[model samples]
Target: MSSLDILIFIAYGLVILLVGNFLHRSKEKENSSSNYFFASNSLPWYLIGTSIIAANISAEQFIGMSGSGYAIGLGIATYEWIAALILIVVAKYFLPILIKNEIYTMPQFMAYRYDNRIKTILAVFWIALFVLVNITSILYLGALTIKILLDIPLIWAIVGLAVFTLLYSVFNGLKAIASTDIIQVFFLVSGGLMTTYLALNATSDGNGIIEGFKIIANEAPEKLHMIIKSSDPNFTYLPGWRAIFGGIWIAGIYYFGANQYIIQKALGAKNLREAQRGMAFAGFLKVLIPLIVVVPGIAAFVLDAKIDTPDGAYPWLLNTFIPSGFKGFIFAALIAAIVSSLSAIINSTSTIFTMDIYKNFFHKTASEKQLVKTGRLSGVLAMIIAASVAPLLGRVEQAFQFIQEFTGMLSPGITAIFILGLFWKKTTSNAAFFGIIISLPASIFLKFVFPAMPFLDKMLCAFLFTSFFMVVWSLLEGRMKTYPKAINVDKRMFKTDRVFNMVSIGIFIMLLALYIVFW
Candidate 1:
């Protein structure tokens, strides 16, 4: 890499540290859980939106997604597009209630909805998912990609990232982490766009987008097609349109709307309106992500440069397409994306552990200071665990798919309970409890024992079955029980601030037009 590139990367890191330090000062001086965990509900919509996106999309998209795209085609974009529509739902429905309830963590929302048992169960599951599946897997892939491109050891890279992420999150908490995420989001998007543009330009032909697509299309047809059924027997073959539309759609909604690490930014918003605006803004951004993440994958496939490995496409693009001077900047941005996601995971896990687990179980009367301290301590502990486990992520096939499949076992059921509980007051605590418990074991069995069932489709089935059980059980058991009054989620909770809302809607429309163009 050029000296200019190295300088730019160092400069980027300095800027992130400066912003993180600035945010650290702006945060409430008092070490309180409210500020540490929720950023004192002071985050504006834009900051929250950027932080949410930064934390949600990491090397998973940069490496796994690009790799999948290189391997699968534009079809891999189903994750982002489906999530865009889902975010709209989240903005309109979920954000309002979640903010109105004023819960610190998602599991806290569960406690309010059902009983403590359900809350504790969901919280524990989320912590496991965040630490072992989400954070560790993403870090593993991110570090591995960096190692491949830079000729470094994967273990050293993982440790370095873990140390940096833990350092800021441990002291500055979500406020510092989320604040840095705003800057990280910009770098991630810019670097992604640069890679896409350069990859398209680096083809044997010229730099026109359409011409590039055409050349690739004629050159490599397999990478462009979106049809890959389980019967295909090819190991790298992806889910088809049915899986995309049905399975991915449901999973996206659950993830963007309900997952702790993703939604914590929304939950930390200044108010319900800000939270809705933030989510809608994120929805808009989600629409644009596929352009940067998925299209490049398709580009590589069309180019057919003998880079057969999917995971290598991203690093390959950087080495081949990006200029030496700017490569450092792109690598720094990639690292920022990785660290931001790690911070988000660490902070959220700590929040859940301290609030939902510790406070609920052992220290019901814990002070905000005590809670914050515990959160920071937990953040340190969780980081160590996530870093240690990161190496194991290599064991999983299609790291992203593995994360989804296992998390899918729980997400659908949890989503059902939350959807029913939030809007439908008729859902009894018993129903919520039973719906979640039954879904996990059943989903695990179906997913492992019967892999041929189009895994996501099976998850949908499990969701439906468990939901049906909840409804049936509630009716049978709750008929005689006094019906609780309907929840009074205020309309203001769903409304967005006009400025952010207008800009967000405009972006969403633009994304829709692009989706249609690509489709």
Candidate 2:
């Protein structure tokens, strides 16, 4: 990129930091643990929705998923499209229970439903995972983008991204993170669409988006199919029909429903209605994500761009097709995606550690001011560790697939525990603990023992196995003398505003149409 592009990128970062700091300072009077971690439970629907998407659609989606799109075609979009459905389910079913509990963290919810032992165990696990895996991977991918596009050293790029994220997020906490996410989402979507448009126009030699579509269809129709046959050696990761009706939901529900960082925005909403509405809004955005992240890869394919690796597809498109000033804008958008995610997971890592581990175990009598201080310190420490470890992840071929395969092992068991705990009063704490403990081993056994079985199918098998053990163990233990106060199981709690309902239906219909057209 030219010097002008670098200036534009720097300008974007300054704007975000200023906006976030301004908003955070505006709320200085309400300094408390609740304010720091949950945004004082005052976020409106639009902020919640945009923050959710901003936190979710990071380097993984832009870099890794786009790479998959280049390598495996539109079938890779099954993850994005299916996540829309999962978000709807999470909003209607999961948010009500969580909001009613007035819980700050997922592990806290586990503690309430079962025991502190469970909460402490999961809390430690999530903190370690976030620092070691989530933050590290995001930083690595983001730095990789800058290194490739700007000829910068990878270590310097990693440090730059980490410092930029910490500037906006570490001091003010979730309030700052959510407020800045609004602007981040704007850049993320608009810049992404701009890149897509340019790539498509490039494919068609400046004719039009419609012409570009026709070129891709005429040249490589196979890339447009949403479904792939199992026998096709090229697309084994997405094993045909199972992509629709199999282990994907286990992964999806765990992410949208059970994950701390993704659901923290919802938990911070002004009201349950706003949270539900925000999730529905996010679901709507999910439908559009693939257009920005995935279609450019297909554009690269149709234009016959020379890319040595699948992950190179997006960077190649940006370097080749985007103009100088516009390239800076898109680069800023890419940084926005990366920083938004980094800020989010960093906040959550601090949240889990502060509320679940530190407050619970270290200082039960700690004041609200002290709690906030602990959270900030934890956020800095987590970022330092992640930045230190991120460069080591460069060896992985497809960072996206690596994340999915590893996370899938834990998701199935966690999903099972939550599903039963929410709906089944008979489920004993022992059963839930056992389910969580057995998931990884079962997933690994299936992966290595039956090497031919697809990963999604393996996830399904592990989920079922964990679930069976839960039910059998619960039945053997008999009903607890007293169960956790059953979550407000009333159907009224699940009701949505009329606008949300209408938009949800519209999103569902659009998804159906896409599947029918692409099937």
Candidate 3:
């Protein structure tokens, strides 16, 4: 890369920090708990939609998912495509109840739906998951890219990314994160597409992107399959139809519906309709993500990239294919994805600890000022702790698959407790609590007992197991009586306007065509 590229990257970083700090200063005049955490419910549909994709892309998709694409072929894109459909289901059904009840956090919803004990338990669980698994994995993956681009040690790369995130997060909260995320998504999408161009163009030996596509299709037909066969070596990872109708749903629903960082943007929307429309908007963008992330990996594979591991595919593409002048814009794009996502999670973790843990148990009488202060301090502390632990993640076969499958161990249990508890009137707090407790052990036991079982299959079985226990316990408590806290519902609450419905239908058709073409 040229010196000009380095200056471009540096200038971009300064711009982002300046934007965040400017927002921070402007926001301080009206600082309040709702203002800091939820952007004072002022987010419009566009910001909500863009910010969701910005936060969702990050190192996990860029580094980790592309690694899976390199190793497992384009089939890994099922994660992105399936999420488009699930986002609709979540918006139409889940968001109505959450928005109506004025839910600030996922744990608050658990408290309203079941009991405070459930709230507290899950609050602690979420705080741990966000810090240990979610935050650290992202930090590790982002560090890999930084190390490649800057030619720095891995530990220093990790520390630099953490500091980049904290510069915006501790002071600005969701307002800064959300506003700046619009710019982040722009870079994420544009830069990702640029990388895709480099990959495909290089794959064609400079023929063209279309020629590159044709070459990939002719040479790697097996890689293009949407469904993995039992005979395929990667079948255990994907498991054919199981990816469509089985445990993947458990992961998708829980992630799009219950994950605090993803859902927090929607929670801060101008209104319920805005959030639903925003989700629908995000679904459309989801369809395009594969071209940016997965296609580049497939291109790497087709071009015979000699990467050391699957996760090395993206960085290898950047180094080998990127032209001298474009490196700065591309680096800025990658940094935008990493920092934007890290900031979103750090802000959400601070929200959970402050509202669900600190305010609820540690200082019940704390004022809004104190709560806001705690949110900032907690953001910094979480960043420090996650940065410290990130370097320990070492190497993985595929960080994206590892995250989804291992996290599946917990997702089914959570999906059961939340989804069932939302709709099933007789669900008891005891059953919900029991479901949460039993999820991990059941998943581990299943893995050991059926060592060859596809993780997708294992996830389905575990979900059914935990759901059965929840149902049985609830029914035994009393078959006919609805829990007092059960959410009251009417059909109108689930209804969407014509525009949203049309968008949903369009997304479904788009997904159908994709599977049909690729199947």
Candidate 4:
């Protein structure tokens, strides 16, 4: 990179910090526990929407999923496109009940529906998953990307990203994080698209994206397919028949519905309507993600990118195609994705620890100010732990798939717990707890026992098996009666307005067309 590129990069850092600080100062209730964690229920649909995408699309998608695209083709896009439809389902069904119940965290919902034991246990589980898998891998991947792009040491890159996240995000809380996401999304998408355009354009020898895409179609058509056959080596990553009616549903619902880190964006909404609308907006954004993140990887493949590993596909594109001055803007976008996601994870981790563990267990009489302070401190600690562990992770091929599979380990029981706890009145606390404890073992058992089973199918099988156990346990405990603490959800609560319905239908149709064309 030239001196000009270095200057541009420095400028972006200053602007982001200034914008974040400005947003933090603008908030009157910044110190309130609710504001710190849930944005004081003051976020509009757009902020919630952009922030959700920003938090979700980090180095994982940019580097890992892009690499998956290079190797596996458009089939890898199911994770993004399927999420669009899942966001609709979550907005209509999950958010309504969660918002109505004033759910501060997913664990809090577990407690509200079942018992304090469920809440505390789930909270501990979430904190571990976020810190260990989510935060650590993100740091590892982002640092790895920085190492490749900027020629930096991986350890310093991880620490630098963590510190940058804490500087702007950990202190100001969700409000600032979500607010700054507007800028982050701009950089994230635009930078991502810039990479895509650069790769595609370069592939066609500077013709254009459309011309390059046509060339790609003529050259590597197999990369355009959305479905993989059993004979395909990558089929295990995205099993054959992976769709809404498949195991993708289980993963999608768990991610968009029960996941604390993602849902915390909607939980911070001004109202239920705003949250629902926000998810709809996020669904629309989800459709664009594979275009920005995945297409570039395919472009790299068509161009015969020289890289040692698949995950290096994106970074290789940057180092090869992106010129000097523009490097800063594109790298800034990468940082935007990394920092936004890291901050969201840290904040959510802090929220779970502060509300579910600290406030509930450590100090029942903790003041609001104290709660906020604890949250920030926990956020700092989580960053430290995640950064420390991130370096220990060795080379990961298809890090995106690794994350999904690991996260899916916990999803089966958690999904069953939330699904039954929401829709079924007979689901007792013990049944849910049983589901949680058996979740990891069930997935692990299936993994080794049925070694050939695809991870997604394994998730579905585990989820169904776990759900069966929960049902039997609940029914036997209830003696054909509803649990006492059953959630009192009305059918009307799931109803959506015309706009949200339109958004859902639009997303469904778009996904349908994409799958059909790409399939």
By summed lDDT, the worst window of 10 consecutive residues in model 2 runs over: 479-488
Clashing pairs in 3: none
Error of 1 at 180 (Å): 1.5
Give the poorly placed runs of model 1, Cα more than 4 Å off: 26-28, 204-210, 221-245, 395-404, 448-450, 480-486, 489-512
Q: Model 3: number of clashes?
A: 0
Per-residue C-alpha lDDT of model 1 across residues 273-343, encoded as one tens digit per residue: 77777877787788789878877877776666467678778877787778887798788878888888888
Give model 2's TM-score versus the native structure: 0.97
For candidate 2, lDDT tens digit of each residue in 1-519? 999999999899999989988877443443588888998898888989899999999998999888888888888899999999899999998888888888778998888888877788888888988998889989989999999998999999999999999999999878778988989999999999999999999988999999999998999898998999766765457888888889888889888898999999999999999999999999999999999999998888877778898889999999898999999999999999999999999999999999999987899999888898999999999999999988878766477456657777888998898888887877778888888999889998998899888888888899999999988898888754435534547788777779888988998999999999987
In model 1, pairs of residues that clash are none
**TM-score per candidate, chains pooled:** 0.91, 0.97, 0.97, 0.97
Error of 3 at 289 (Å): 0.5
Please report the TM-score between candidate 4 and the true structure.
Answer: 0.97
Local distance difference test scores for all models: 0.77, 0.88, 0.88, 0.89
Off by over 4 Å in 2: 26-30, 395-404, 479-488
